[model samples]
Target chain A: MTKIYELMPDIQGEEMLILQNLCRDYSEEKLRNFATIYRTRRKDPLLILVLTLVGLAGFAGIHRILLNQIGMGILYFFTGGLCLIGTIVDAVNYQQLTLQFNRRLAMEVHQLLNREV
Target chain B: MWCLLNTFFACVLRTFSKKTFLSLPCKDFKSDDGMKSGIVRFFVHNFEAWFWLTSLILLAFMPPESTQTTFCVWHLLGFESCLGCGLGHSISSAFHGHWITSFKFHPLGLVAIAILTIRIVSVFNQNYTFERLNKKFTHDKNL
Candidate 1:
């Protein structure tokens, strides 16, 4: 079976280490299941950046909407990205957004998979 | 002399009404308290949907000036140029199918609509996820 590192080659920073340690107890099959679920749930930062660029082209808050930040998404839509300032800010901070979302997804998947069987 | 006397009477009547109005106690309406809480909660919960929905509906129905006049602090302040100056007009134009005009006013109008559409869709996604999670927990508890 593939190691966690092989499954999530792109995982980095604290998440990489945390996920590695958290999944250490799982069997090969359980780890595969976790990997499948996490992969589906996780969002790529690069994808967020791409969506933010789409915001620049026309839609200003698609990235925020994708991140499940409906409040901020609505704000950005109504305010024209707060006169494009907020959109620029989000463009710069998309990586952080991606990290936060992925982290939450990781935890949720972890909890779901670890439920007593 | 008759006109002068009539003017004097009118002045006295105005003054008397003013005095009585000023002397009246200011009453706070009790029902307003309940209404305020409900209004606040409405905004606090799922405010995004309400905001976008309101904007879309208003933009579709009301003329641009009506919505623009109230919310635009920058315009009210007499600023020659502000970041959001043309955005409302742009959105209004887009709603009217004036794509080129809308872009001319503010290029982000279409983007705003797209983002709003996505947000609306995600609300459904959010509810579905919540239900799925709830069911998962209930199933786990049953077992």
Candidate 2:
């Protein structure tokens, strides 16, 4: 299997390091499978940023829901993105939000792969 | 009960001061070890429920209709409309059993209340599947 970082060179910084650490114990086949699954499921921070910008028009919390924060998404939708203040904050921090969501995804995927392995 | 209340406030103080939820420095407290962990766990696990319940309580106290004294940043900034204009009024009306008016004000009020109730009640059980699903989509600061 490809080295974790080389296989997913696009993911860098903390998330990359995190995935690498989680996969350290994985067998080669398990790592390849994880890379494949994670690549498909990973959210694009850019997409979340675009969606947050969409809040200026309407549909305030779609990105939160995409990140699986259903309650927060609903709160944002009902509160008009917490009167748009929260939306602006979210827009500014979309990368962090994406990273947070992706980290959780990585953890879950890792656990599932472990089970399978 | 008193201890629980104190722990709740401790959690709140940490949240405001640190600008994070579930990132409490429980170990720094001088409280007894077992109780500290219990309180921290309680705060960490029930953070969302407390958040929604607090919001619900606050909204309940707000005047259903915006008064002259009410301040709206949207109106202040000269925006014609905003996504959450009538939501507060909607929530208040819904709480008072004014379903039609609540929906007319904001269609999401009842749905929000229902969701919050579900969330508040779900804290008692550890639904591992749902937890896993939720974890996949949400970030835990303490994690």
Candidate 3:
């Protein structure tokens, strides 16, 4: 499945083989079986920025939202007003959190690329 | 309600960022379906994305001028001052020829300004190998 950006002919030809190698034999049944499509998940830079903005505003939960970790994002949102504990915790572990979300998103995208359309 | 908003924003992220790992996508994704390999690359790229975002957050808190005294965003955020306090003042001192003041504020501030300035210039000159440099640092850190 061609990602939207690579649909153009010239660009398509240039990186075709490389892209083909990247997206391989995962069957449609396997993809649907996985529950959430692993490859479709993406970390929006804007969301990351907003999350970081919230982080700067001493709201670590914002990072959770960017990761689609809704439960935690809210916990932090209300709790954020109370202290810096969450923010500090986030700052320390942000790398892990961001990585986790990206992994989830990557799986989803892989599924999308598998779609028949 | 706020929780719903958070979910909405997360959806926005899902819609906009197509490939997730620094914008890479499987265009020619035919039968081979390298899910495992793609994940490895995703993790590798995530490190970078995290670093860049963290750096951005760090810079975002750099107190602004003119209203530096009156408008303190960090304070608004409910945190104490950062380690590199008075950095802006130190930078100003460096330009104003106040060496003592610059060092007094933050000894490393001027050096940071210098290195970053040099790198920015190198980027403009197209001599900057950002990926290679990051790899070197990543290696050094591991070592």
- lDDT of model 3, residue B22: 36
Candidate 3 CA-lDDT value: 0.43
Docking quality band of candidate 1, CAPRI definitions: incorrect
Query: How far off is residue A100 in model 1, in Å?
Result: 0.7
> In model 2, which regions exceed 4 Å deviation?
A1-3, A9-18, A68-82, A92-100, A111-117, B1-54, B66-73, B77-83, B96-100, B116-143
Candidate 1: residue pairs that collide: A55-A59, A58-B111, A59-B111
Candidate 2 C-alpha lDDT tens digits along A61-91 = 9998998879878788767775665566566
Candidate 3: TM-score? 0.30
Ranking by DockQ: 2, 1, 3
Across B11-69, the per-residue lDDT of candidate 1 in tens digits comes to: 45344433222111112212334545434433322334544565566556545444323
- Report, for every candidate in turn, its global Cα lDDT versus the true structure: 0.60, 0.66, 0.43
RMSD of each: 18.1, 8.2, 14.9
Candidate 2 lDDT by residue in tens digits, B1-143: 12133335545644543323223222222334555554554554455455557667867765676444334467677977654657767888888878899999888878777866775675434323434544343333225
Task: Supply the global lDDT for candidate 1.
Answer: 0.60
Return the lDDT, model 3, position A51: 65
lDDT of 2 at A6: 81
Error of 2 at B75 (Å): 1.7
Q: What is the Å distance of residue B120 in model 2 from its true position?
A: 7.5
Model 2 chain A: weakest 10-residue lDDT segment is A84-93
**Residue-wise C-alpha lDDT for candidate 1, range A10-59, written one tens digit per residue:** 77754565466456567898899988999888888888998887765547
